[model samples]
Target: MIPSSRNWQIKVAIAVLTLPVVFSPVSEAQVSQTLKAKESEAKQFMGLMNKAQQVYYAEKAGFTSSVSNLLVNVGFQNKPDTANYSYSIGMVNKAAVFNYGVSKQANLKSFVGGVFLVGNDTQTILCLNAAPGKIKPPNPTNTKGVLKCAAGTEKIAQYNYF
Candidate 1:
């Protein structure tokens, strides 16, 4: 009788521990909301990076690949990388470049932002991967003002200023 009672208690404990993993609409919705919140944070951070790059470019006549440079020279106050994402910047072209935020968490959206020098004006675009997978930053065209996202990605925002 004691052995049977102990086995029952162990089984109940296991079931309770696994309850969160069980398939349920409420859990699914909660996960979706959490993912969306993470994506929003990523986008907002990328946007801030974009603006800092723009300012750095104006003052230095070019963009810096170093986040510390942006922080010191452009007065960018936020951390370069976040808990959910790691960031990198590269010059895709002489007059166009991109910043990439790679997702560290599974199922989280990664982001990319492009800055293009179009004549006397600057055009910026932000894009995100259509699916949660390896994200590659788009190589923007230097000849045109527009920045086109690669396959499996979609544009989410754009900024144009003189």
Candidate 2:
């Protein structure tokens, strides 16, 4: 026996409603993976900057604020902007720092100063971006882990990004 037309319509409606439920988790996972990739890229950039600063310091006894100097002179010529991130290795108050700007403007609210790492003579300091447009606990604080930030900044402890 065949089902009535009314019954078939009810089944179709149920299937349509359930489609989103099945796909929602997949969408969320995709986004999470993408963010993870972006974070990895950011950390890689930080490392490259560290090497470049070392070279510059070895030659000049201090750091340069120009990203161009890091890329052209030291030969770390990777793309400055990734698919989901843009960044600059520069000076804040004559101190060397690495700043990251995300493609998602909404995320900017959570990533104030777009800076994740700062550096000095012996160690690296992870700047805490707790507030919008400002990094809290000040520089040289031992909150986040250590990252080898470029020269011209403050540092004291070792921390890991992953």
Candidate 3:
């Protein structure tokens, strides 16, 4: 009688623990929220990079060629976690080019993004060839833009999905 009661209690405990996983909308919503969070981070990181570039270009004629230098100058010991993207900056076409996206450890299968921000204080915008985010391209020819880091028909969708 004691063994049977113990087995029954164990089964009850298991069912109680598994009930949420078996029938819960919370997990699905959480996944969607996480994806949205990553996208938000990407946008915030772009703004941060733009600020850093502003400071760098003000002192120098051109943009910094290194991401580490820019981060250090901007007073970050490491990339902030508020964003889910890693950043790399360089000089392209005489423009400060900032690229930030998910790292390999963040996505195992594939990471489909590289948002290119090119411009100085006088002129800059997310490149036309870059992900437009449903907004029309400012420059279809992309010649008026001083910098570009994308090619072909690639488009960065919401959540940075291809």
What lDDT does each candidate get?
0.78, 0.48, 0.47
Best candidate per TM-score, number? 1
TM-scores for all predictions: 0.79, 0.61, 0.52
**Where does the lowest 10-residue lDDT sum fall in candidate 3?**
108-117
lDDT score at residue 88, model 2, on the 0-100 scale: 59
Tens digits of lDDT, candidate 3, 1-162: 356988999999999999998868888788767766665566556556656666666666556757677778889787543334444553445543444433323321112222222343433333322332322222212344433334432333322111
* Predicted structure 1: lDDT: 0.78
lDDT of 3 at 39: 58
Ranking by lDDT: 1, 2, 3
| TM-score-better candidate, 2 vs 3 | 2
Worst-scoring 10-residue span by lDDT in model 1: 137-146
- Residue 150, candidate 3: Cα error in Å is 5.1
- Predicted structure 1: clash tally: 0
Model 3 gets an lDDT of 0.47
Better of 1 and 2 by TM-score: 1
* lDDT, model 3, position 63: 65
